[model samples]
Target: MILLPTINRSVLLVIPKQPFYDWSNKLFPDLEPTNMADIDEYNSYLLEDELFIDDPKGELKSYWKKIFLNELYEQCMDETTFPALSWKLFTQWFDFHRSAVVSDLTSDPLYTDE
Candidate 1:
């Protein structure tokens, strides 16, 4: 069972123990597989800038955005693994940075709309 707090209420999600264990193991291979703390910590890392800074050309950032969207889609398939706030944080950052990148290019005279 996992508890998530929303704006107006708290949600409780229950998962079968065996499947939860398996999913947890796949998500967190280095730690004790069933621990929510480990999952939270892993999610926290996804919010870090370092995760998208490896590629000099910024392709890795776009790649990670797709990966995160895919993860969000998978999580939506099961409430028990749905990490709503974490997904929001990732997408908010991704969208903001992506737009900033576009703006930087468009702001130049060579790429102007007019």
Candidate 2:
């Protein structure tokens, strides 16, 4: 969908593996289902447990965190890609960082008081 005008200004129209962000409601309301609740639920998709996937500390990189992070930054900052690629990166990073903040939050502690 990235190649589509709906995705960005770039005619090349390339969608990365992960959307990295979701403004479909703001960007395209017409795409929503007819039901309002469905739209609300869909809007909440980003905050749901499954969508918060992250490779904390670069374990996926086989202990090479720096190289993996560099690649992630490049994936996020390729100025040659779209006109707003940098903006996309910024927003994505913000979402990731913000999620990291709340990820540890819990109503109940793992260790309970007797």
Candidate 3:
């Protein structure tokens, strides 16, 4: 879902753990399950967009999750560190970056949930 940037852990939790690998070559002829060596794809896949809601205070959690996801994406970019980390990397990342995470995102056009 390229349109959504909700990094809320709950939302991501419900997402298929391995959307790329879970895809069947036969089902999605255009998107066959293959190793994603592309940098752009990896970034978009791992990082969720900032979250905002009608109420300014409501979207805090979503923004926090987004930050955590972004951190995980950065770690994955490093081949040395990424090789050892598995799909559960998000767990470690969320715990590690939990402090820095905040719910500051709110109706910001810069981080459109596109």
Candidate 4:
């Protein structure tokens, strides 16, 4: 068995819940709808571990807006189709699953576009 490399990163899985699917369907009824069974295919964001050290719960708030926008953009690039977003709406639309620790299994060096 291969050992995974330890990385100083945390994970946040962004999953679109039923409300999100309903809204998407309302916009484009002809398009194939997203089902709960396919939720595992959603996005996973890797963030620095330090971001969660102080207040694991509240610290992520500062980044939520960007994350939310990214998720919305992934679904539909047209910003005009998106509803007015707020903390409450974000919570209602998506489910956030967080992991305090992450292990990078690859031996190759990591890189990011940004």
Question: Against the true structure, candidate 4 has what lDDT?
Answer: 0.79
Q: lDDT of all predictions, in order shown?
A: 0.37, 0.30, 0.35, 0.79
Worst 10 residues of 2 by lDDT: 5-14
What is the descending TM-score order? 4, 1, 3, 2
Per-residue alpha-carbon lDDT of candidate 4 for residues 11-68, written as tens digits (9 for 90 to 100): 8888888888787777788888877666668888888784553553477777788888
After superposition, candidate 4 runs with Cα above 4 Å error: 1-4, 53-57
> In what order do the candidates fall by lDDT, top score first?
4, 1, 3, 2
Candidate 2 lDDT by residue in tens digits, 1-114: 333112111111112222422322233455642332232221111122222235433322332233224434543444343334343353343332213122323445445255
- TM-score, every prediction: 0.23, 0.18, 0.21, 0.82
Using TM-score as the measure, which candidate wins? 4
As for candidate 3, its clashing pairs are 5-49
Alpha-carbon lDDT of model 3: 0.35
Clashes of each: 0, 1, 1, 0
Candidate 3 on 18-48: residue-level lDDT in tens? 4323322334466645433332232222223
TM-score, cand. 4 = 0.82
